[model samples]
Target: MTKNDEKYLIEYINLKRHEYLNDLQVLLGYAQLGKMDKIFEYIQKVIDKCNDERTVFNSDMDSIMKYIKNKIEDK
Candidate 1:
């Protein structure tokens, strides 16, 4: 909620956006080279990495919710 926190969050989002754009460019290069196998492998790797990130995000949210739930249980 603080201005500093907001600024950091915005920076993080922009950094991630740039990273995704770079990834797409890499994929485009592979396609231009007609490397079908490499393209598929790269795509699979990206998907797997995204899935792993999602799992970590989910677990983090679960922990936050658990803390809130425990607080409510005590009231």
Candidate 2:
């Protein structure tokens, strides 16, 4: 990805870092529109969410990260 792509991805992660769930939904909507850039962006958000909610994903963190990483990489 280019620098701006990286920047937006990090921005997405930052939003999720604070648990902005509603906004996350909107961003995810954009991602689902086949907007690879936006999908990559929201994937970072999801990764951050999964990271911050470790206790909630105690058994799935690794798998979740692996899946998300694959999606991001595939983009």
The regions of model 2 sitting more than 4 angstroms off are: 1-32, 55-75
Please list the C-alpha lDDT of all candidates, in the order they appear.
0.69, 0.62
Q: Residue 65 error for model 2, in Å?
A: 24
lDDT by residue for model 2 over 45-75, one digit each (tens)? 7778667657544656456455445445654
Candidate 1 clashes: the total is 0
Model 2 clash pairs are: none
The best candidate by lDDT is 1
lDDT of 1 by residue, 1-75 (tens): 556545655665666587789889989999999998999999998899778666655776555344334434443
Worst 10 residues of 1 by lDDT: 66-75
Root-mean-square deviation of each candidate, in angstroms? 9.8, 12.2
Off by over 4 Å in 1: 61-75
User: How badly does each model clash, as a count of residue pairs?
Assistant: 0, 0
TM-score of 2: 0.31
Q: Estimate each model's TM-score.
A: 0.68, 0.31
In model 1, which residue pairs have backbone atoms overlapping below 3 Å? none
